[model samples]
Target: GGLVHYVTWPGSSRLLVSDPAALKHILLTNQRNFPRPRQQMSLLRKVVGANSLLATEGDTHRAARQRLNPHFRFANVSLVFPIFVETAHRLVDRWSKLIDADAAGGGAAIIDVHPELSHFTLDVIGLSGFGYDFDALASAGNPVTDAVNSLLTPLSLFVLLRSAIPALNALPLASLRKEKEARATVRGTVAKIVRKRMEQASEPVEK
Candidate 1:
């Protein structure tokens, strides 16, 4: 909504807009006239290797947004609040027990509560955000969420590498093998949950 200057990477060329309305006119009102600047899209395309919502342009983005909007809507979120409350309470209770254990043993316990909090948040968000229960706060995280979290460190590197030396990843190698294995673990876990839900949905309703 304000003036913006576009700077070229290897060269020196400046593009500018002075009027606020004109800036909006180009960026939002008529965006197709200027696609994602090469600098940003190039990095995105290199990373995910698919035109996901963040990377999608024009009509594809509009369509995807329309489809996914309901999942993020307020009304849909209301249905999952009980799950969120229960999971949060369970997390508090678990932490209380850990503290209790340390007190009883007369020794200070060193524990990173970060992972515990993360799993709780994931369970809550999964249920509320997507109408799916990840149950990541259980004895252990639900398989799908656990696998995904386990792979996050490696996946972050994968994204970084893709953005940095994308073409080199095309070769079959040890790194690729580890990436594939991690991806497979995540996929299998998610597929199991989806299949179970589908089977349940297909069952005949009792009168």
Candidate 2:
């Protein structure tokens, strides 16, 4: 697909497309000519915090890609379709109830869509990615939800800063303290889930 050039500040570089043909020319046609740009690496380091598919390049990236590819196979994804459908149906049912309630109130009741949409998206992630229903969409006062809502503003600014500086991220293991703490919280939660899944998989299945 073709990409439109984004008009932005003078010093900032415009977005790079990396279209299939462009990707092929850089990757296979001139395999040894490619390297991960420093600018890209700096942005990836903030969230992932180390050598990730975004941060690494060459054989290291290729090897990691191969290793992770199995997790996304068509057969594996097919197994999870039912879980996704159930979550979607739950969302629809919720909206239907709100509509009914509004009708009872003679169309005078105001329904808030913003918070419900956010919870719906987050719950979808929990269901599809982690194979657990977060139930954030069910009602008000979901305790774990405030943690996610608080990060939105800072996360956007951090991503922008990462793309702009591209060198400050290269300073080995140092970052703005608040950003670092946010990154730690997100990554730590992911790590805990990984450990839990690994342990569960290792245990014998109970009949």
Q: Best TM-score goes to which candidate? A: 2
lDDT string for model 1 (52-119, tens) is: 67788899988988899987778876777788788889888887888889989998766677677778
Off by over 4 Å in 2: 11-40, 93-122, 136-178, 205-207
Model 1 scores a TM of 0.58
- Report the number of backbone clashes for model 1: 0
Candidate 2 structure quality by residue, lDDT tens digits, 1-207: 555567655566655665888778877677668766665566566555567776777788789889989978999888778876877798889888888998998895466777667777878777777866668778576445554444434345656665777665555553455555666676777678778888988999889
Regions of candidate 1 where Cα sits further than 4 Å from its true position: 1-58, 105-114, 125-134, 140-146, 154-159, 167-176, 202-207
Clashes of each: 0, 0
TM-score (C-alpha, index-matched) for candidate 2: 0.61
Q: Which ten contiguous residues of candidate 1 have the minimum total lDDT? A: 150-159
